[model samples]
Target chain A: MPSRSLWVPFELGRPLGVPDDADFQIGVLKSLLGLFNRKSGPVIEDYPIESPVTAETDAAWSCTIPLPPLPDTTTPAEALKQALLQEVGSLAPWHAESMRRMGRTSFGLSGLTPESMPEVAAFLADVASGENPEPLSGLSEPLPIAIRYMADDAKAYYMEAANEQPGSDSPGGTRMWTWIYHETRMGQVFYDLRDRLASEYADRMAANGGERPPGPPPINPISARFAVRPEPTAP
Target chain B: MVRLKDLPKEYAEGLLNLPIPDYGPAPWTDAPDLKDARVAIISTAGIHRASDEKFAGGAADYRLIPGDLDFAELTMSHVSVNFDRSGFQQDPNLVFPLERLRELEASGEIGSVARWHYSFMGATDPSRMDETAPRVAKLLKEDGVNAVILIPV
Candidate 1:
């Protein structure tokens, strides 16, 4: 397939070289479209352009949205649920702004809506309490995306509510997401949930005498060759 | 400059191990002259018009993107978190290239842009794509497209 594909060395999630570079983008398009001119069985072309951003640079970047005190290890399930509900309520404005900018999100894979976020909060709180809640229903493409968006938005809302900054200058979705996924207590919770889920699946596979599914390699933050900065400790 | 093959071992394994259909070499078809051919684009970036249903779970589904639609009216709903979306956020042309195709049409580099383009969420189950591809090919044939450019994200 390499002979038939045009390869670009851009980061995951970005197929084009960079944001806001029309000339570079147009060049890529021209090069790709040029493939049709070949009367050959297979052809592979390497894009010459280099992306200015690197994983190191991206990893080093952090969001400044302040976060509340970390939920104590002994935090009750009901308390966590209450906090998540409040976070969702706080994110209403930001979510609305995102919708206005990007159009209504098409992510409703859990068959869950913002109106039913309490159900989601309850599920997460249960997971946090080390309870094996029922698996999310409708495990599909956009459903997982929708659930992620919900989790991200909840983290953003919690941070914003805890921040000293005025509401007039709230961070955008990307910044909030970067911060939530990379730093903060909520990020840890999300990561923990992911790890637990992976472990459970692996156990299930083992029980069924099936091989565990392949997944992306784990991040090695301590590697000297590709050192990613340590995440900030949650307050 | 890591290509898809260079992705983290686990990620690459997941994608590389996807069940791809065993397809043989297709007979080579010479492209019509660029200045006379009707060109169309098909992207596996999971793009859809705002009015269309979002793609879900390796769906064997596709959406039609009218040639005249605005980039702002398009959105991506793929599940993969591996690609950088900044370029797409800034200029959807990075993935869809609707505007670039339009420019080529205006410049006569291509005879015309197809009235409709197609999109499927890439990184989907290959079997689903295998099923959907022929249907999309039929649609392209109906639209009289002479050349196709496939972009994968």
Candidate 2:
């Protein structure tokens, strides 16, 4: 518990409500700073405005970039790898445009550049297929950690490019997330990796008497959960 | 929206059932007026400079973000993928609000922006932060930060 806290009923990632709205953000700051005048203890105030993007649903939004058809391969993982690499290649120009305009991106969480995004996808595909490939670019983190970063970096790369397209900003991140998981081959790749990690995690748990073993298990199940968002069920 | 009724049933239940840490009695201090207060932002959004170490699962450490650091240089390596990163990707202000604070300073709403801000990855057990909290408080005091806004995402 904080001595003074202002609770805003915004979406999970957005604390100040909407992005790119200066007046609203300033208003939030004023509300928070105004708490100082109360001279009271442990004040937990609720912010009074509902974010415009709250529970925002964008059913009409879709990525404009068309991906090349997936190549047929004997191995399913290889097909995923090829398709993901092509997907990244197709989005490169738009991502570059977004970079030119924004001057920076959140795409390098895995220590790999946006140009190296295809490699990150390939790494995950390999892991998904049950091969323990050496860490790319000599990253010293364990396989689970590397997998988590690569997965995040993959989605980040795609979202940055999508943001460059028209109508990308309408409903905010949730819409983009819906598009990523429901429409793209990259989304399929995420599901495959999650399934692979889940198997490994179950084995670890079973060996440890149905409880997680201490100090970083061989596979972190959380990574698998983070890698994919399941399609929303019908009410 | 964060109202329990608005969230998915499982997630809302998880949050409701979470064990609230007992931090003993809440400490109280009267803050300086908004115009006289030097404010620092403390976010649990797992954001930091691109060069900083990534937060592993349940890691308790925090990162220092210089107020003047370029927004593009900031990145998030928070361990959870459950939250939306799209907002932060589109605008850093939604998470950090440094720009908003700067506007307030220019308008004379607050005394000043602290030269440094801090971020810690959320989802870490708060009890694990016991050792580091005091040190952060000391640093805030040294920088004349009489008020801090703890933003959770």
Candidate 3:
């Protein structure tokens, strides 16, 4: 079977929409479900369009997978990674076309190597934390604009710094911020954020590098990889 | 002082008099009828379970948690949700309001809840988004869900 079926869009770990706000979050969840309503093979469509830059609206997206017997989380996760990397590479050409439509000028595939995953992850940390750091060098065009590294601990802590200040005294913003801060406090986000850097051995490199995994199988899950802090009692 | 672009006739008559909340979506339409339909949620603020092994502060996942927003709860937020995983927790208000939804579901205002709902962290990326999003759709299809309520938390 396929190493992985589909992927979800949000952050790396957080799968659902939000932790609490069931209504709007569920709306997003339903959007994901809308994907499977397709009667045929896997179909892709965009929805809930409120803006022109719809895809990058930073809104989360999801898909569904029927649960019969999932491979052990570890095996599937590993296989899924290979699948994801293949998907990433597969879309490169399409992304090039998209860049052309978006008025982008250049793309540097070499810059997206494992060596670049940490930098991209750092840039994501910066962007999520309101840093808006510069893009990785050599990327003349903004195709795909993502990097992947192996799973580790330190990277985990920084990746979770994705917090915004709470407003209106509502608990939503504060609760998520608390979660990320808690991750940072636990130092796990940092570790996962740079996992590939930790395991950059020569053997780690896939022969295809820019292609899908071999043997139609071979995946690993970064299981329970996120580090959570103890919740404090609210007075 | 009304300019052509800021004409009042084109806007609401009581626009100036309308009291807007400082945060959250401004309600224009009546509340959605949660009858005989599944209500799914999508929070932009990254959310994830601390228990998931392949967690990251990016890539939103839409795993549903049952009975989180009941009335008996004091302030049941998805605090345990992992932001390091979804990053959508950047706006927790978007992610952990299950306690609130559970409250609504209990009042009988909402019809039978779906067996599953969804979540995913928020981040920026343009290419291959559809590829990343299919997992949520697969879950909903399997759960037999119909309606979804997207929360930009």
Candidate 4:
């Protein structure tokens, strides 16, 4: 049990309410911080307010801009890589703008410059083709982390492109990401790479006496030890 | 307002499958008065300064975020897309709440905010916490922090 904590009812990412809504955000913070006064161990308090966003409303959100089409199914791997390069080239300016607005970015892994996305695409294509892709120099992180950053870069490219329209916001970026990850050909390639890497890592771990390597698990949002089991159903 | 009961069936079912860590009994600790306590935030939000090394493979590594840094200077890089980033994207305070902490300090709600807060990639395997948490506790104690709020995403 945690010594002290507050459970905010917001979705996984947003512990507070809406961004830019200072009053609500502060209220939630104050309530959590107030836990300090309790002279006790293992306090778990729930934030009084509820989350304002819902799956129904979140699902209804969309980006106004359309993403570029995936390369033709029959396109050669080199051509596909070139197409991805073109997409990143077009999206670079917008990616920079988005980063500027956020005042930072999560990109820095793999040491692969934004211009090296073609190589990333080629790597994914190789993985998809059942060929083992060689790791790039200075890219010593686990394969999953490398792929995640590549996918993130792709998501950023698409998001910035969609944000070109006025009034575009985070939901718009979310929608763009959903489309890119679930609907595009490159997305499929990414999925394959992730699957292959995860299985390979699991095999390696198994061979190493089932000891996990020094990294996060393939999936996250690790649950607490306690769970609320449903009551037995009436016969 | 959204509640766990209100989650979609698929999501609710998925949550049911997670392995709950056995934290055993709740070990209670006396806390200082709110107005006299030096508070710090420990978030599993995977946040770090732009110039800091990115967390790799759910590494047990943590980043020390100076309490006074601008919210815009922090960024989330964890691989899990399970959580919604929209709110975080708009206002990092929704997850980190550093700005709000500063406000509380200014208003005397808390004695003071720690010079440094901490963050870890939230999706990390729970086993790693055994080694990491104690180290962080030592650092917080050394920094004179009397209260901590663990925000798990």
Candidate 5:
């Protein structure tokens, strides 16, 4: 319990309502400061803007980047790798533009540069193919953890680049995530990884006499822990 | 904007079922006027400089962000993927609001901005912060921060 708590109805990621809207943000700030004047015990104020506009509520937004269609000439795993690399390559300029325009980015959680998106995508491709390749260097966490951050970095890179498209406004994370999971080959890779992780966990449990093991599990299943939404469609 | 009930059932249930710690009666005190208070932002977004250590799963530590540090240098490393990062990717002010705070300070809506801010990753057990909260409070007091606005992601 706080002496002055402001309960807002915004989404999980956006506590200040709208992005890039300074006036609205300032309004929220002032309302919070107004709580200091109550002259009472604990005060939990409901910020009057009950239904604030947010990225998730931006119905007019969509991804407009021209991602090339996936090539069908190679093995599925190889195709996934090539397709993701091409997508990353195609979005490079727009990501650069986004960086220049915003002067900041939310990438680099995996301790890799934006320039390393391709490497990260390739590694994910390997994961999607059920290969336990060596984890990328300079990662502070174990492979399972590093994979989650790398996947997030890859998503950020793509989304940030897509955000720089000229015509339509940027969609919120919900729409973008749906588009990524259902529409892109990268999404296919993620589905494959999720399935592989699930299979591996089952195998471990079977090896343990069909009983749960003690302590932390061998892997931090992204699907279980992170709860990636928009359940993967049938492969 | 999405309300608690609007979220998916499992996630919504998880949030609703989180254990709330009762720290006795909420501490009360008279606060200085908004025009005279020095404010600091205390975020649970796992934000830090890009080069700083990333928050491991359920790590019970916090990061210090100097007020003078470049906003561009800040990035979030929260372990949860349930929340949206696209908003933060486009405009960090959505989460950190450092720019908005600066604007308020410049316009005299607040007396001043604290010299330091802090962030601790959310989803970790709040009881784990008991030992560290006092140390952070001491630092905020040292920085003359009379008011703090806690933000969560």
Candidate 6:
């Protein structure tokens, strides 16, 4: 078993679901719920791809997704659509509004109209909302590039931390709650389709279903390292 | 785990004098006389614009991607953070902490600022950084940066 808690499904930085998208945001929480069920029982979930490789002409964007090979299920086009659907299924209608609000509060923004777009949202629509559900293992080409990038980081950081200094031992190795928070604080990026990035988090308890203390809404911070660098290591 | 007061007093003094073009104090202490340290930043702002690609895989373990768009304006669209601008105009901590790093470089706390930095949208898988960090390491190496700070957005 990997010696760490797994948390992926919120915003790009804080993978616990953004506060705004109340309904769909729960997907992040649900995902966490799923994580708890993995009792050394190989828990492997697949993510659908978002964005079309052919549409990806810009080298910068192209580099980010690293378009993968066509899935065996169908044509590359079908694979692309399947990828987009899963993303859309996990999203909320207010995704844009929430993102805008988030951008305003955290990133800075101009407005939510058509003209002020920083980047084209449609391109993502194709990829994120597509429905080709396949294990990340099947992806090759562009996407594997991105996935391998993240997996390698997680593995290395843990190894590096082990070498640096031993961490505090909460009951079961790293507490699920603390581990989740620590990883997010360490700068864990969630797997796709926007609305899941929320910083407010609490260790999931059998009684508390995992909700942070409520109140005080001043742009919740998610692991300061992400706020500035990677969240301070739990060592 | 550095206490606030314990932090170099120069940093606070500098933060106060920012937007003035010349912040007098150093950015970080504890850092060895950083003549050429490499610095990198990680953003949880989930910032990749519609222009950038979202994360891939079961980060069901890490929440990320297929972000919605707010076509309204581009004030801070350049950045992907979800911060409020009420306090950030004169100081732009929202995007990447360019101003802050610049202040450090100006004060000589850092030998020199790396020309380029990394911007991870923050919601994807942190486990998969093996793929991301190297890209940054490569970029930094190409630019001749020695150490990386990794400013979180």
Against the true structure, whose lDDT is highest? 2
Clashing pairs in 5: none
lDDT over C-alpha atoms for residue A115 of model 4: 53
Better of 5 and 6 by DockQ: 5
True contacts kept of each: 0.37, 0.70, 0.13, 0.52, 0.69, 0.02
Q: What is the fnat value (0 to 1) for candidate 5?
A: 0.69
lDDT of 4 by residue, B1-153 (tens): 235575656677767786777767765667788888898988888888866887765688889999888765676676565545545655678778888888888998888999999999877777777888889999999999998877776
- lDDT, candidate 1, B35-148, per-residue tens: 888888888888887568877656878999998988757766665544344345445777777787888889887899999999987867767567778898898999999888
Q: In angstroms, give how far residue A136 of model 3 lies from its true place.
A: 31
Model 1 chain A worst lDDT window (10 residues) = A218-227
Misplaced by over 4 Å in model 2 are A54-57, A138-142, A168-170, A204-235
Sorted on lDDT, best first, the list reads 2, 5, 4, 1, 3, 6
TM-score of chain A of each: 0.58, 0.81, 0.23, 0.63, 0.84, 0.19
Task: Please compute the TM-score of chain B alone for each predicted structure, in the order given.
Answer: 0.89, 0.97, 0.51, 0.90, 0.95, 0.48
Q: What is the interface RMSD of each candidate, in Å?
A: 6.8, 2.9, 18.7, 6.0, 2.7, 20.4
TM-score of chain A of 2: 0.81
| Model 5 alpha-carbon drift over 4 Å, by segment | A50-57, A137-142, A212-235
lDDT of 3 by residue, A1-235 (tens): 0011123343332344344445655555445434433434434444332212123332332111111222334553333333333333433344444334433211222234333444443454443333335666764234222333222222222222222111222122223333334322122223333343323322344556744434322211122322233453221
lDDT of 2 by residue, B1-153 (tens): 378876667778889898878877755677898999999999999999988887877888899999888998999988776868888988899999999999889999899999999999888988999998899999999999998998888
Sort all candidates by TM-score, best to worst: 5, 2, 4, 1, 3, 6
Give the per-residue lDDT of model 4 (tens digit) for A1-235. 3466777766656677666677888888788777766765567777877655555555765644433454565655544455555555655676677666766544444556555655666776676555777876655366656666666545544544445445533452234445555544455455555556667779879987999977666531111211122232221
- Candidate 5 lDDT over B1-153, as tens digits, reads 357776778877877898998787656688999999999989898888888888866888899998877878988888766657777877777788888888889988889988999999886899999999999999999999998988887
TM-score of 1: 0.68
Candidate 3 lDDT tens digits, B3-122: 223322433254355454343333232223454445555544333333232223334344444434321211111222222433232223334445444555666545545565555544
After the best TM-score superposition of candidate 1, give how far the Cα of residue A158 lies from its true spot, in angstroms: 11
lDDT of 6 by residue, A1-235 (tens): 2211333321122232222233333333233223433445334443222212111221222011122232456554445444333322222223334344434322221112222111212223232334323433322233323223222222222222221222321111112212322333122222222212232223323235654445322222232222333343322
